[model samples]
Target: MSRKLISSGSEFERKIGYSRAVVDGDYVFVSGTTGFNYATNSISDDVAEQADQCFVNIAQALEEAGSSIARIVRVTYILPNRDDFQPCWPVLQKWLGEVRPAATVFEARLLDDAMKIEVQVTARI
Candidate 1:
């Protein structure tokens, strides 16, 4: 099978040389997605809101790749501050619910100081 690339038209992909997501056979790998609204290219400073938008962005990429959050098998969350984890976790649980995929959360500085969270997902369709 041939590999397929998915782009969400985010300028970062062009600047950073990466696709938003890639599909190979039954699997899809999504790049770390931030909360910036692609239409407005704006990201809020609120940690919980940013976390929710991050998942929403990932869901969109997954959909473009012919998959959904329900199909997600794993996820990795990167947070600049560990204290932000508490606020983000409830939002994540609200979106993912019982369909929780294997996930890991780690602290790391983001590309921008305003970016509170980023999420990367893997799924099979």
Candidate 2:
């Protein structure tokens, strides 16, 4: 199949020149998604809440790309504070425990301080 781009209508997608997700052949590559809820145009401060929001945002992009969370084959989690990672375990397990995708976590700064977590995933379409 030809490559397809999915967008969440975030201004950053236009300003930064990146799509929310890209579907190529049988796989969908979701960009590093933050906790900002496009629908509400807001983000949470709590790390665990932000982590859950990150998944909520990611799941939407995946669905738009003809994929779903269950199809995720790989995942990467990013947080500015490593200490915050533990608080997100339950939220992470809630979304990914059954799928059990190959995963990694990194402590890194995000574009916005309100964004406590970011999630990127690769999934089979």
User: What is candidate 2's local distance difference test score?
Assistant: 0.92
Q: Give one digit per residue, the lDDT tens place, for model 2 in 1-125.
A: 99999999999999999999999999999999988877788887788988898899899988888889999999999989999999999999999999999999999999888888889999999
Clashing pairs in 1: none
What does candidate 1 score on TM? Answer: 0.96
Write down the RMSD of all candidates, one decimal each. Answer: 0.9, 0.7
Residues 1-125 of candidate 1: C-alpha lDDT, one tens digit per residue: 67999999987799989999999999999999898887777899799999888888888888888899899999999999999999877898887887789999999999999999989989997
Clashing pairs in 2: none
After superposition, which runs of candidate 1 have C-alpha atoms over 4 Å from their true positions?
none
Worst lDDT run of 10 residues, candidate 2, spans: 36-45
Could you say which candidate leads in lDDT? 2
TM per prediction: 0.96, 0.97
- lDDT of model 1, residue 51: 88
